[model samples]
Target: MNYEKRGGGSRSLPARVGRRLWVTAATALVLTAAVYTLSVRTVTGQRWENAVLAGRRQDETLAAARDANHMLDHVTVSSLGAAVAMLMLIGLARRRPALTAVAVGTVGIPLLLAEVLKRYVLSRPELVDAPARLSGNSFPSGHTTIAMSVLFGLALVVPYRLRGIAVGVCALWAISVGAYTVAAGWHRPSDTIGADLLVLAVACALAGLLARTGRVRPATERPSPLSALFLAPLCLVTLGGLGGGSLLLLESVVRLSPADPAVPRLAYAGGHALAAGASAAVTVVLLASLHRIDLDDPAASP
Candidate 1:
């Protein structure tokens, strides 16, 4: 059942695919959350919107300035941000070998599971108030889920030296996205919360598995102090935000660049596929390289 293929010389290709699956899950979760909220609003009638929606709850921030146009925000908010933390922990796992196992296992297994759940269970997003441009099913917030997984996944592996800061940053990013989604009228507040919880559950289960693998201590015994200070949580969020922001900027640049109307469709799709593939490839490489840094260069160890 362990889909995690052991690395022979370095990380196996399965590992790379498995890692990419993690980001895919994260990306898919946001779309899925959007879809789920629409369905919930249609059927359930005001699940989270009527109650917990902080943005709509009191936001009143809609102005002529227009909402922020953030597409790859999910990449930074969910994957890039958590990825750095998860990878950082993986690096630390060398000293805490058990944690290293947890990091890889958590990042690997549930990633696959999240995808299957998205395709079969969720409905696509479509509503009058919802963003017209979006096209995908949503049950759980893929973005929220991925964000939680990366941050919480770290809780399973980080040394006592860095647990508080790790969790704090993770929570901040997820919360910001959740708030923005509600404010942007993209999803009901409850849907986002549910997705966040789902990711936490997935992450915790993965952590437990790693513990069973003798990678880290048990949850009850894992004395992770609640160090999520207001300012402290802001630490790694910039990394993800910047990555996503940069990609968006590149997209703008691409749009401004000279176009090829000769073969528009193929080039457009190819360009997108290339970008997605590249973003995903870089994410995996960065994650794996971060993990292997100490092993590849001993002096780098803390």
Candidate 2:
């Protein structure tokens, strides 16, 4: 969470860029807020709403979205985005006091749009049962937009040496919002992706305008050792077989007739456990090597 300054001088080239990004976020906040407020009008006859409910899986999709709803457990990314914005504001307090001014100036639009959208749009899945706290047009997902406004917006403040990583982090966070929204059945793929792009466009425009200048850095990554390991046919078949075998076992259990009492209920727990382990192992290894900030570590020097 901390970075050792790469070089020291009177706000070197990189520092200047960071300053500019903060400035851009400040200004863009106001403009995007204005646009969000002006753009959230409702359509007649529920055209978009009807389209989302189309298909045989319509009832199932609506049900899944309802099932996916949880108070705070699943309502994530929204808070994460706010926390990140708060941190940026705190960090930029001193040298970039103007950044604070910008944050203050434009905090109203996203909030206002979220509320307006909630009231104007009338197709929330939960509302189908009966109106609850969350209802209205979900044309643009709130969680997805927050992800863009905060993470993608912060990309400008990221050091050029680390901008790529910053952008990837932002993307991952944005994608997570898509997963949450779609899994919750609160938004269609079209809704979430569209919201994500609009947010990114606004963020980029603001970040770019404030950017005094830009520079490109080269990537010099070495291939990981595990590529050869995973490339083996045995490894591929083992991984695939484990996954398929686990699903087949589960399917067999699910399809068994209720009258057939002889079918062992938990026989494939062992197979399922094995498949889970294989998946976890692969994820753990990939995540462990994603980055190596050790080059900047004081002890890493010869």
TM-score, one value per model: 0.47, 0.41
lDDT of 2: 0.39
Show model 2 residue runs off by greater than 4 Å. Answer: 1-82, 89-94, 98-111, 117-136, 211-302
Off by over 4 Å in 1: 1-42, 46-93, 105-111, 124-136, 213-302
Q: Per-residue alpha-carbon lDDT of model 1 for 260-290, expressed as tens digits?
A: 3322222222222222232232223222322
lDDT of 1: 0.42
For all candidates in order, the CA lDDT equals: 0.42, 0.39
C-alpha root-mean-square deviation, candidate 2: 13.9
Q: Relative to the unseen true structure, what is the C-alpha lDDT of residue 95 in candidate 2, on a scale of 0 to 100?
A: 32
Tens-digit lDDT string for candidate 2 (82-141): 755673665374334333333322232443455465467423343133123223456556
